[model samples]
Every structure is written in structure tokens, then in C-alpha cells.
Target: MNKDQQPVVLGKIGASHGVNGWMKITTYTDSVTGIFDYSPWLLNERGQWREVKVLRWRQQGKGVIASLESVDSREQAQILTNCEIGVLQESMQNLPEGDFYWRDLIGCEVTNTNGYNMGKVDQILETGSNDVLMVKANVKDAFGKRERMIPLVMEQFIKNVDLLEKQILVDWDPDF
Candidate 1:
């Protein structure tokens, strides 16, 4: 996506909560309440993205139910079910040092310490102990590896990450 593009989805609108027009919400942030931090959410309604404010919200059991401004009826709330809730991408909070967002690492080149160009990071998997980088390798590699699962363990596997250079240095064996 273009860096200047807005509308990074933080959550999705679920079914209407009550007759009072409250709607169930599912957030995609670190905490269930994190999505609420960015209010006046941009909701994708039909083909258009409409801005709506969170007038009130409460956590009920494991899920969240909310009431939005200008939506005061169950029918109005039902119309929003399944629509995405987004905020401008530029509005995302910053992270500390050594931290990288998944989006930034998706296209990074992976290279072993032996100087073998492993591949580009295709995806990241959150395992029980730590994260793993799924590297899609070149078809002509000596090991015939189509993909490699490199643990994102700093010092153990990952040596360095250069975001500006778009490359990852690893302590991996190319023939493995």
C-alpha cells in the first residue's frame, strides 16, 4: 500500500448489540481496547468510507459492544454489521528501538552470514516461543530449498535488520 494512503483497518463491526443501536466490535490490536484509542473511526459502508465517532463503548465478557454517534436505532446499527473500522495509517503509534512492524518486514531480503542470498521474507508466523520468518528462496539454490523457516531469534539466528537497506542478516547455513 502507498505510505500516504489512509484507512488501516483496526477492527470490524459485528452484529447490532441491542435495540438501543449498540454494535459488537472485534479489534485487531495488541489489547482489545487499543482500537478505541483511535476514535472517529473510518467505517467502510457499502462502497464508501464514512467517519463515525464512538459515543460510548464497554467491554462485555470477552467481546466489546459500542454505541456510535448518529446511529441510534437497531436497524441503523445492523446496516453496519461486518463493515471494517479503520484509522489513517499515519495515525499509527510509533514503536521503540529494535521493534519492527510486520508490514515493514514483509518484503525484506534475507541473507545468510555465508553471503548466500536466501530469499525475501514471505510471511511471519507467531509460534509458541518466538516468531518465525518464512523465506521464499530462489529456485536455483544449491540446497533446492523453495522456502526456509528461519527463527527470528536475535543472536541465535537473526543477526541484523537493516530497514533502510531492506535486508536481513542471519547466522544460517545456506545448504541447510
Candidate 2:
């Protein structure tokens, strides 16, 4: 989850399509066609890795229905319900400069202008407009810890992102 690292998440599996091995997928990407490009995709079945082939697929409603090569029954497809799909680190395309995939920003460190370490990014939460960074912060006094969510806005609060150092320099204040 380093800032320099790249990972392509194929999104979560939806309901089974038909009696065949085809299943629906809820994609977060702009185009469902992106998923069909990869021949063999890595499926996360409750965090375990399972390789599945995308024999045929099309976008339907808010998701995509894909026919897996070996999946022949609804019951078999049903087993993949809610499974998360991800590509290997080597499968992603090279991004343009200043453009980063969400997976790359998940574990970068966030520091304020005054050198106060805010937190390390735990995950990225997708909103309709933009994505938010979920930061896991350490509590100095309390025994319990807390997480803070900050918006990834451009030129407003974010100052710089040094991927080589795995750090993000923000203009946010600790009081906020």
C-alpha cells in the first residue's frame, strides 16, 4: 500500500446472474470495460485469493455481469457473492504524472506544515464527489486510538505529496 505501489481493484461481486456461472459485479471504476481487459483476474473470497477467468461480461444497471469460464450453476456463482476482485501488482498500467490510483495512497504518511505527524492512511473511502483518506492516528495519553477522515481536495488543504518518501504534506491544522 505504498504510495509508489500500484494495485488495481476489480471491485466487489454482486448477485449471481443466471443458472450459469456468471455473476454480477459492483464496480467503482469509471468503466466496466476495464475489468474485461484482464484475462485472468484475482478474486478475494473473504480475503483469500482465487483465480477466475472473465469469459464474457457486460455492464448492467449499476454493475457488470460476467460469465466466468468454469462457473456452470447458480449455486457456484452464488459462492462468489460479495467477493472482492483485485489484480496483481504487475498487471496495472503505468499512470500519468500527478495521477495516482487510490490503492497507491492508502498507506502514505500525512504530516502537517508544522512537522506534526497526523497519521498514516489506513484506507480510502469513496464518496460521490471525491475520495476521503481514513487516517489511523496514535493516541498520546489515552489507551484507545482514533481514526480521522480528511478530504483529498486539490490545492485547498493539500500542499504536496512526496511518493518517494511515502509522505503527504498537508496544510491542515491539528485543531481541526
Candidate 3:
């Protein structure tokens, strides 16, 4: 995928199922059955793009079993095991009102209450109940510099997010 393209991490291959070319897919969506709706799934293996059509899909106990259009043997399915499926970001639906995808929030500049520059948000952790923003703060020590993570909660932190400017204003203390 191009660097300019928005990543649309669709699903990932979990393990090989039975003796056929079926694969257990752990999808990022709520409904695994809906994965078939998006045809021509893009698989990323060893940093290469491979397009495969969804032949069929069915719900298993906890995950879903998907069979590709051309893959017909266990060996063929093994090649796709652990492969991450994704597409360009433009293919996804637009985010609604207050909702924002993780990709959108990442790379936004973060600042503290006293206008102290924290850093940029590298990623967000979905910690079951609430999400935590991992801010890549460049901390300078004696030797050189390093990065740190600041938890973004509704307490005395993360006041606002200006999507237009791609920035996050927080109410936090720089010294822990």
C-alpha cells in the first residue's frame, strides 16, 4: 500500500481449519459474516499485497471460517495464515458525528494544559472499557532522547481534539 493511502485493516488470518483451504479469520468488525460483503479482500503477507476473492464464509463458534476463491488446499491456506487483510482508507465509510477511527486520531499533535508540547499520538489502546492514547513524547535525558506514553482519560487530561488542525489539547502535567 502507498504511504498516502489510509489503512483499512479488515481482518487477519488466524489458523488453518479442517483439511481444506478454509481459514479461521479474526475480523475487526462486530459481525464476521459481513466480511463477505467486501469483495476482493487485500491480504498483506511479508509486506506484499495479494488480492483474493471471498468464495464463501460461515460463522464458527467464536470466529468465522472463510474460503478464498482460488485457494483449494491446506498448503495454499497456510500461506495466508497470519496475513493481515486491509484496503485503502478511501474504501471505508465516513466517520459519523463524534466518532473517530483510530487511524484518524493517530499522528495528531498533543499538548498539555499549560500549553506544554507533549508530542504526537502514535497509537491508541482499546483497553476494554476505555481507550488510551499512546503519546510519543520526546523526552531528553543526559545521554540522548527517548519517547514516552501518556494515558488519555477524561480526568485532568485530553481536553479537546481539533480534527481540522489535527491536534489534541490535553490537561496534563509533563512530570508525571
Best candidate, lDDT: 1
Q: What are the Cα lDDT values of the candidates?
A: 0.88, 0.76, 0.76
Better of 1 and 2 by lDDT: 1
| Residue ranges of candidate 3 with Cα displaced over 4 Å | 1-7, 30-37, 141-156
lDDT of 2 by residue, 133-169 (tens): 8878766613244777778986776788878888988
Displacement of residue 76 (Cα, Å) in model 1 is 2.7
Q: Model 3, residue 23: displacement in angstroms?
A: 0.4
* lDDT of predicted model 2: 0.76
User: Which residue pairs come into collision in candidate 3?
Assistant: none
The sequence of per-residue lDDT tens digits that candidate 3 reaches over residues 1-176 is 56566457878998888778998998876466656656568888897777778888899997799888888988889988999988666567676886666777889988777877777888887676677888777565322324445665655566787887998888766665
Q: Report lDDT (Cα) of residue 111, candidate 3.
A: 77
- lDDT, model 3, position 23: 87
Question: RMSD for each model, in Å, please?
Answer: 3.0, 4.2, 3.3
